[model samples]
Target: METTQNTFEQFKLNRQLLNAIEEAGYTTPTPIQEQAIPLALAGQDILGIAQTGTGKTAAYALPLLMRIKYAQGQHARALIMAPTRELAMQISEAIIQLSKYTDIRTVVLFGGVGPKSQIEAIRDGVDIIVATPGRFMDLYFREEVTVKHLNVMILDEADKMMDMGFMPQIRKLLEIIPVKRQNMLFSATFSEKVERLSHEFLEFPTRIEVTPQATTAEMVSQTLYELPNFHTKMNLLSHLLRDEEVFNRVLIFTRSREVAGLVHQYLLGRVVREDALRVIHANKGQNTRTNAMEAFREGSVRVMVATDVVSRGIDITEVSHVINFDVPLMYEDYVHRIGRTGRANHVGQAITFMTFADEYHIRKIEKMIRMEIPRTKLPAEIEMMETPRNEMQDMLREIDNQKRKEDPTFLGAFHEKKAYRPPSKFNQKDSRARRGASSRTKKR
Candidate 1:
């Protein structure tokens, strides 16, 4: 018996897509692609469960492009919804690349910038509309987008959309679009919310899971550093980035925009060059974020610091290390953040900095991923900075809050004093005054 080779050509894609795939340097299909493309091509709705950086975009985009074939009418025939503007743009770029040899035009809609240009793109001619839910609905209400011609609808990062509360808009969209269209839903992790969304979005869909849900990439090595405070994490980050060979192309993730900015500022001109470090968050301008992302992708930026805004869909294959400057409270996002590295079967490192308060979240993340991250001791040469008094108090308060959340009856340290108090001299005097007032009232 002879076995056939697994290749994109085996899918019977058109010559144009085959050419584009070859030019794009794709040798073979990824697991998700191998499993999903055929079902999608057969006009079956797909529920794809795959982690980030697993060629999920291609798995869906290729089939969508093949179905669209060529641009025909002035309206879009397909709609792709993403949770964030960054992810919307990323998917649009991938679709454009895959459909280069064809005449299928795609227009990306997002809210950070004005809709003037996007409206113009739609007016000119578009076969596909890739957009965030809010922006898509905005354009739809304005009569700029018509769903009558839509034959396909896809929800990329459905779990993220559920997290960001896009369900109402999604439900509204479902009502407006043609009910006869094929549907596809892709999620990095399958949660209860995602499962419910899948039931609502897809009709008797064929489910494909390339990997066990929420599992990290096998090529990435994960390590944890239990530091005392944020300052010590900064110290460890600085020390790690000093070694250029190993830390060459790095992505640092923080939980908030403020932390992302601080990480960028700390590394500027100290560990990374001023021009080689870029930061992005929800607060950054659209142009600034796009330029920073482009620069990082083009290899001009050595280190990019970002919040979870860019975690789910932005695909950068050469990331050498992903430094979790702060543990993510949303445990699923931990999988997406580490996935920024170890892309395309490349060996990568994921280093997490966990403070005392972060330990609770880290445990939750480990439980979700079904493995404990290896802990490493700080190098002897790097001095562990003493945590400031205020920061220590904040961490303690956070820990107390976490504990209280887990056990509602368990009062926090600050609440313990209020819960039980011995009778004081002031309390005794107040009690005597109350008793005298009660006796006076009784005499009256």
Candidate 2:
């Protein structure tokens, strides 16, 4: 089907919503939005399979808002469940912007924060709710929310939700929600879990798969580098940045937050402009992640290092390049990481730095995706032995130590709150044994 000249006009969106979209600088609808919006507005269950950074949020948020605003009902009409706190907040933000014309209220609930405010927000009555499964369950268990009057239900990032061990929570939530409702399952990939969930939740939903399950974005120029284990990735990264043409907006994906911090420190010392480089990850907290993303979006940051946790639900336009500093263990992650660069039909580049140890993961990714990624030569040290797979844990620990040395505030964020440390059941017996052993040693 041909895309409409103006999706806003074609959908006959309310003037206020259209005006908000225009102000947000979105006139034409993205592919997923173009197809899913009409079906959603028609009160049809939809199974939308599209890649990340494809504007799928708006695809569901827009029509859901329109329907909620026009239709009459109460009892939390719409419930949108996202896999992570970041994604829940993002979806809620989109919904709020789209629902500005009407009196529709959206409440967002997620973990890692106080629940009092969220409870009050729900108590006050909201037309829509976007939440992470864990916090949402907390609210439900407290009897702060009900779904008997729910009109629509949305499962965003369905596959990631399963990966994050949210299937049980989702199943429980499903039981509470009214059976008669419009269901929408939007996922980046159609894995077996997604298909199973769709079969169970949706009732003859209209299926829309915009891209192949393991397909990377077509606009992304993907390449790989066969770097040796001993080669300094920092020097090679600096070499790439020296080109001057690749500056402005570049993202580097690493396997851990510690690695991300190390890369950020390395870039900070050499980039000449500290303001143009930053790091983001799950351990950074919401505020820091939000700030880092905003800086990158405003063109204030030339390079942003991130972990996979921060890779989901992050939408930034005009990202010139995405560099995989470490190969992703999962095949779908390879798709989302590269999807960040090439967005909205703009051409972008993705380069992966691979060591010999990464050969297994690279092969797995290739086999799963059914395509070989083209390889390029490394900077130097071609004869170096691969880092033993068993030594990867030690490498990670060493990286953590290096990050602490470089970043003074490395552990400060985590220090403010104490993690759970359960007491040992044998503490009394162990203490007695230690005292007896000390007395015996003194006699000796």
Candidate 3:
């Protein structure tokens, strides 16, 4: 099937959208955009399955903006629900840019900040709302936001929303919103949960899949390094970042906030300049995360250490490398993480550092991607560090848990061992005395 739109003009988008597209330097439509824009413009529900960084935003945003050509009402006509605040903001920005020539007004609603401004924005006027489910519901319950006019609903990163356990809120939203609405659902990978969601959310949707599910981007060259411990991984990361020219504009993804912080601290003033390094995770204030992301996008930050919070949210075009400091347990995220670098058809590199505990997840990720990650030998200059005893035990326990998950009866090496033993003399004497007392009482 041909999924390429040679030019934006071919879609017959309004002159305003075309101008914005030209200003945004979008010469040709991406695969998802090519397939979804026409269907969306035709007022059909859309189920878009494409890897991240494939211009999925524009695939839906352009048609959405066209549908809402001008802001006429006080209430929003379109609602776009993203999984994270960062994504909500990104989507809002994209829409704002696309709708610049029009009178469309977009407001982003998210937690971690006061709702006063969001409420004020909605009260003043908004044609489109880009929000997370919780924040949208909060404002809706408070009667601050009205959804009676919502005729278009979009669920961006639907898989991530499901993973974040936003189903109940989404279901509630569905019940409250007008049933007569156009729906569009986009995801990097369509898992079973997301599939179920599609059945509930979409009505006779036109499914558009630009790539295979969970497949990494073709422009990204993936490499894996099997290390012995966290310390070694850190050392290897430092060594790789030392090459300033090649590793410029890198995004380092860790599985947890603690690991992200550790990696940020490890590289500060050593391998990366203090001013050129930034770290972002859930614990960071919303403003702090926004600033870090902006810096990384603007080329002021050489390296950014972050958790998966921004994996599917961030949309930067010049990222040179994406380093997986820890293999993602949610295997689908591997595609999103690597998709960050190889964007806009630019060549990018995805390097992963896997410890023993992470090997199982790496294998699963490989299976999902349907390709084995080529292993690279660690540089000899970097000395291997010894794994801490506690760290080693944790890895072993994790491995055991993985094994037990696979085999119910498999006892781990750490499982306690109980052997048969005779009772001690003290215990034996106490037992005899207790038996004699009981016999005397019975005779009496």
Candidate 4:
């Protein structure tokens, strides 16, 4: 099936893969897909620079699925490594959907669950394995999985995998896999580390970047609120969530599991429809997390409160808004967080609640994305509160940090170490006196 130019059909994909692409309703290719698919189909290694929702999965998966014409061996012929279970499962799901008309089999391997089923699936024969670094390595070491037959290898969110400290496992896998296999790495942002990984893994790879490094999707309208404290932020959030038209299918991102839980609980308790709210963090069980995400995807849940855990991983299309209940400490995550909303050419909203302490963090984020988030006035009805004690302390610490940067001698709470002093003379004397008095009394 020799294809002409500029369309997904332009790639000489098999009948089933082509049919799946058509059935999947992908007519014109995304920029990343446009550049990557042809190169990947030609058995070339690819370094795709695109965010999570940029159709990158199809860019590589479509070509890889087409390449793996049939399911023949017990060992996987292709492997995709992701940092999180959600991402691994998502990639697998995309592959399955694309290859629905074919016999190509895929199994997702991630930690958090028993490997018995995964091992059995691999033993039964699979052509593709989408796995996390740890679980994949576990199965490999246990002799239940092998890469000798692998012809294509992909690392999605390579930056994230590196961030999560998966390099050692990735390096080990690099050493184990066949040297001649085609390798592809896709990331939302490029860094020195990603460059290093690419050099070590991909051989003369064709680089494709649909968007610039750290650039947020142009489709997203970014907004900011300078709330004084957490309670005000929550009040504002509650006010916004009441507007079903704008806040429908929302994802709220927080910095920590604690905040994720708090936000989830606050919303869960207030929303009359309990089934419409779900929370996911590191503490949630695998089934719980999966169910929550799945429910959110299916529109059964209107709100999802998540930590950075799924910022760069989960792909929930049709998210009308992404609310940053707390500014991300890691600036890169702001890009990823907003990405969850403006996906697949859809115009979306990204609202960030910035406290006094978050000013320092938001500057870095704005600089990274090359634009400051537009500040919106808080509703006149919402009562703003004073800076909380913790926030005040954080501001003081930040100020001290800046002062110390100017002059190392500047003492801040963080830089000042409490000095240790010996026990007081009076106390020591009192202890000795008491001990002597006790001894005398015992003697009497």
What TM-score, to 2 decimals, does candidate 4 have?
0.89
List model 3 lDDT by residue over 1-444, tens digit each.
Answer: 865449998899999999999998889888888899999999999999987788899999999998998988799999999999999999999999998899999999999988888898888999999999999999999999989899999999999999999999999999999999999999988899999999999999999998989888889999988777788788788889999999999999998998888888989998899999999999999999999999989999999999999999689999999999889889888898998988877999999987767877988998999999999876755546655778877887897899999998998866666431222411224434655676798899
Model 3 ranges off by over 4 Å? 1-5, 416-444
TM-score of each: 0.91, 0.81, 0.92, 0.89
For all predictions, the C-alpha RMSD in Å is 11.7, 14.1, 13.0, 11.9
lDDT of prediction 3: 0.89
Once superposed on the true structure, which residue ranges of model 2 sit more than 4 Å away at CA? 1-6, 70-75, 379-444
Looking at model 2, report the run of 10 residues with the lowest lDDT sum.
419-428
lDDT of each residue in 153-257, candidate 1, tens digit only = 999999999999999999999999999999999998889999988988899999899899999989999999877668768878999999988898999999899
Tens digit of lDDT per residue, candidate 2, span 303-348? 8888887667777879999899999876688888888888878899
Model 1, position 118: C-alpha lDDT score = 94
Q: Estimate the lDDT of model 2.
A: 0.80
